[model samples]
Target: MKNKILVLGATGNIGRPLVENLLARGEQVKAASRSGQDVLGAEGVVFDYFKPESFEQAFEDVNRAYIMLAAGYVQAKDLLIPLIEFAASRNIKVVLQTAFGVDADDAIPYRQVELALIQSGTPYVILRPNWFADNFHTFWKAGIDHGQLAIPAGDGKSSFIDVRDIAESAAAALRTEQFDGQAFNLTGPEAFSYAEAAQLLTEVIGKPISYNAIDDDTFIDMLTSAGVPADYAVFLSSIFYPVRQGWTSVITDDVATLTGKPPRSLKTYAQDHRQQLANS
Candidate 1:
């Protein structure tokens, strides 16, 4: 396999582009998903976090890995810790993607995983990315389509990042050792409140879009009524606390620092995904 890199969540937002970036750089990659589906030119491997037996072939002959927990797995530590232990035991380098506000706090499951990596005696890099601009076309697309971008963010802002920049940054961390033992907060160049974001989308998409800042209770009710799990709904609503507190509004140069280019702006993101937004 030529010391391939193992990329978990291989078909996801970051994993897909990360795999493509590595291949473009002439590096061997093992693209892993729960289904073991083929990812373009890379070798395919089946990897399920809930099924530990699948980790062996996925990690076989792998020198490094890009690790990201799947979305909505609030009990992330239960799944991630085992994988980290296995990778550390194999002496494989790890690049972990965690939430933006997660830190070394033991109470947070993702943070617990971060502390595990930090104390694992293995080389690793941590990437904490802010809110994704692509959410407008993915998670909140229905709201956008309805011309009402509603959330519990109040008047706070977030320096929303592009998944492309995150992919490039992950590739850099995986391919190089300079970033080992370091953590980077990847964010866009500017921060925008929901109202401001709605304005920008309106301008770029050539349509009216409104931002409705709702209360936490109302937000939870909406998600629950939409068939989202009650626990996960509360979890989703909890993250907005930071947004409402202005904690997510911090801008950083880490994207450019790692990728050697400025992160994409909201306008650029909207333009690139114009057809998707237009359809919404």
Candidate 2:
């Protein structure tokens, strides 16, 4: 009913906090999810990438949009580009959350979406975040509960960032036109190999957590066995090639640049989420 910030994946790890950050700043928000579930103090609406009709109401009267793909959907370009074009047609500002390192190749689906946004003749900011520290309590939580994180990362290191910093950065981007048309690669202050990360987790949790370097096939098998779709499992395994190649180890000041505070270290993430790590 008011000029609002439309936040997709409104109930997600990043979206929830981003919505809160906007609300804290006294901005109106329209929080959207597939279920149209209510978010804290924000107008709730149903929005789905698979449903184009939902876009109109979600975009109605909204001056800015925080666009990020929901989990488990792999066709990033096909799903996001059209929505981006629609927003561009409406002259709505866009802050897109894409993956780090996608810029190295134009063939990358996320990169294609970025290119589309850049050429869309609309105000846009791209946020390319590195690996998330919350994965310990999420995607890999099962493995941590089992005391071993089995992946194909081998000895490579990644500067894993907390989702909170990402949310803060997105809120910052959406609130201002200063960063329009610029892309920032968000990352943590330090990088750690899976082995080093496991050691850190073990120290923080006082429990023995180990990192096992398996081949991609084995990693895919583990995910498929865990009920992940075989295609998605394989897709997940393919992305690990960058981790194994040491490409994900880069650190950046973008988070500090955007949020005016340093990104949280992995140790801080572990210590703060120790309880969740062990049980959630």
Candidate 3:
């Protein structure tokens, strides 16, 4: 068997496109999810963060792997470190997906996982992506359908990146050693406040969508009331601190630098997913 690239979270927003891109370029791919469901053009394997028995089979004969923590798992290090260690033992290069602004800080859960990767003495590249523009169609679609998007981002802006760019960058890192031992802060072409994003979406989808900037407590309460776990809701609201503080309003050329093309804008993303935005 040829050495395949193992992509964890294969059914996720970033993994799906990453698998597609790699297969298009003639690279072998093993798409791993909890269900072991196959990507359209790739082999499928069962891999779950809470289930360690699945790791060996998933890593078998794989030369490189893309690692990402699935949603609702706050203990990123616990889930990620074992995979990193196993990959290191097998000499498999890793391309890890972490949120933007998480660094080698011991306090931040994701950063602690990052520190382990760096200290493992293995070949690795990290892609820290900004808030995803895709969330408009996925996580926040119900609100969009109601003509209102509510979050606690306040008047601050975020250079919300399209997940496609993140996948492209991950593919590049996995295919080459040029960016090994480095981390890229992937972002879109520009920053936009929630209100501004709403305006752009309104224009593209031909509807009046508004952004409601609520308080953190209110946001957490709303999420919990909607069936989101209280701890996870708190986690979600906590991350928005950077956005409200204007820290996330950063734009970078990292996506262009890695993919050799400009990242997609909010307008373009909304236009491409207009059907979902219009109807969802």
Among these predictions, the greatest lDDT belongs to 2
lDDT of model number 2: 0.94
Between which residue pairs do clashes occur in model 1?
A: none
Error of 2 at 66 (Å): 0.5
114-212 per-residue lDDT for model 3 (tens digits): 888998888999999999999999889988999999999999999999999999999999998899999999999999999999999999999999999
Between prediction 1 and prediction 2, the one with superior lDDT is 2
- Please give the lDDT score at residue 172 for candidate 3: 94
Ten-residue segment with the worst summed lDDT in candidate 2? 1-10
Per-residue lDDT for 161-225 in model 1, tens only? 99999999999999899889999999998999999999999999999999999998999999899
Give the alpha carbon lDDT tens digit for every residue of 118-210 in model 2: 999999999999999988898999999999999999899999999999999999999988899999999999999999999999999999999
Q: Each model's RMSD to truth, in Å?
A: 1.2, 1.0, 1.1
Residue pairs of candidate 2 with colliding backbone atoms: none
TM-score per candidate, in order? 0.97, 0.98, 0.98
lDDT, candidate 1, at 68? 93
> How many clashes does the backbone of model 3 have?
0
Candidate lDDT scores, in order, read 0.92, 0.94, 0.92
Worst 10 residues of 1 by lDDT: 101-110
